[model samples]
Target: MTQPSQSNNNRMVIKLVAIVIGMFGFGFALVPLYDVFCDITGINGKTNPYAATYDVNTDVDTSREITVEFITRNQSGMVWDFEARTKRITVHPGELNTVEFYVKNPTAKDIVGQAIPSVSPGTAALYLNKTECFCFEQQPLQAGEEALMPMQFYVDPQLPEDIKVFTLSYTLYDVTGTSSVAMNRG
Candidate 1:
């Protein structure tokens, strides 16, 4: 009777350990799963890392106008002054436009940062394309240094007529500890 009771207890312990391990694995898997969900549905307006380039010969749609608003933010621990030079712009679809963002590092030490971009009116994210953007690469700024970053982009002519305005926002994150290589590359 004693041996049977010990065997049952051992089996219960093994089961609990397996359950804990499974839960731990599931937690790590959620990150990629969330990304996949956002990509497919465009729910979070996450932009693709790569810029898309269409043929130069493509025609612009001059009749429709799109109001693009730019917004900027600095993540916690990032001590930098950042803002869009132009708050908003009216542009025709398929017409390439450029805008500048100002960034200054006030801290005494050098810092490395990366800008992550997103579009609002999440459905419109698929139609907003970037040809050239500073967000594509990390930025490193020395103390007391300021820089003007440029972004070149266009809206697809096929964007639905119901959506007249869209916003593009960028959040700057300090990547010093996570990406030491980025600091060197910038």
Candidate 2:
């Protein structure tokens, strides 16, 4: 009787340990899951990834002008100089515009960086489309090397009339150590 009871207790302990491990795994899984939810709903100002299949033939709406402001930031411990060349620009809806950002690797060793973008007044995210954006890929800069990153985008003509000003911001994160995992994770 004593042997059977001990075996049952051991089995229970193993089951509890497995449950705890499973719960911990679920917690880590939530990070990506939350990102997907925010991206789809635009609840957190997360900009949608550029879509290659999007139609670009829409007519430019010249009657109204929307001011787009550019903002750049470097994540903590990032040793690169990054800034937008153009502070802001006014454009007609549906017209393609190009802007440039300058980035220099000031450190002695090569580094890789990834840019994550967000649009203020989250509602504007749905109408802002990018045709060509450096944020779409990881940027690798050699020591003391500098490069100009260009982004081509357009404000959809259907943008809500109430939003006359929209801000597009990018936060560059250093991913030198975890480049492979961070590249696709963002």
Candidate 3:
């Protein structure tokens, strides 16, 4: 009887160990799986960070108008004032539009900042094409300096008719320390 009980305990322990290892492996695989899923379904609002080319001959969908809303924020501990100059705009798909963002370094020291953008209703991300965007590069501003950054973009005419409104939000992060350290080392 004693031997049988010991064997049962060992088997249970082995099964539990295997379960944990399997769970750990699955955790490691989640990121890649999520990326693939997003790529297929376009549900995570991930936009191409690189510039996109626009054809001049593309037909403009003048019959339909879409509303785009812009929002901006500073990351925690970042001491810069950042905002979109225009809060909202109505535009026809396939027509080029430009928007300006204002940024100011109120601190006494120079700082480098980067802006990350995301679009709501994730499905609209693939349809939003940016030809030029300040978010593509890091911005360096001197103390008490202010600057206007521009973004040129258009909505693909193929965007789904259901997605008539979308929000574009940007969060600015202060990369001063990392940038300065890299510059000094190089």
Best by lDDT: 3
**Overall lDDT per candidate, in order of appearance:** 0.90, 0.88, 0.92
Cα displacement (angstroms), candidate 3, residue 5, comes to 4.0
Please give the clash total of every predicted structure, in order.
Answer: 0, 0, 0
lDDT of 2 by residue, 1-186 (tens): 699999999999999999999999999999999988877877677766764334668798889999999999999999899999999999999898899999999988888999999999888988898889999988988888899999988898899999999999999999888776332222
Model 3, range 1-186, lDDT digits (tens) per residue? 699999999999999999999999999999999999998999988778999999999999999999999999999999999999999999999999999999999999888998999999999999999999998888888888889999999999999999999999999999987774332211
Q: Write the per-residue lDDT of candidate 1 for residues 20-82, one digit (tens) a residue.
A: 999999999999999889888877787778888966776899989999999999998899999
Tell me the alpha-carbon RMSD of every candidate. Answer: 2.5, 5.2, 2.8
Model 2 gets an lDDT of 0.88
Off by over 4 Å in 3: 1-4, 180-186
lDDT for model 1, on a 0 to 1 scale?
0.90
Clashing pairs for predicted structure model 3, backbone only: none
Off by over 4 Å in 2: 1-33, 51-56, 180-186
Runs with alpha carbons beyond 4 Å of true place in candidate 1: 178-186
Candidate 2 colliding pairs: none
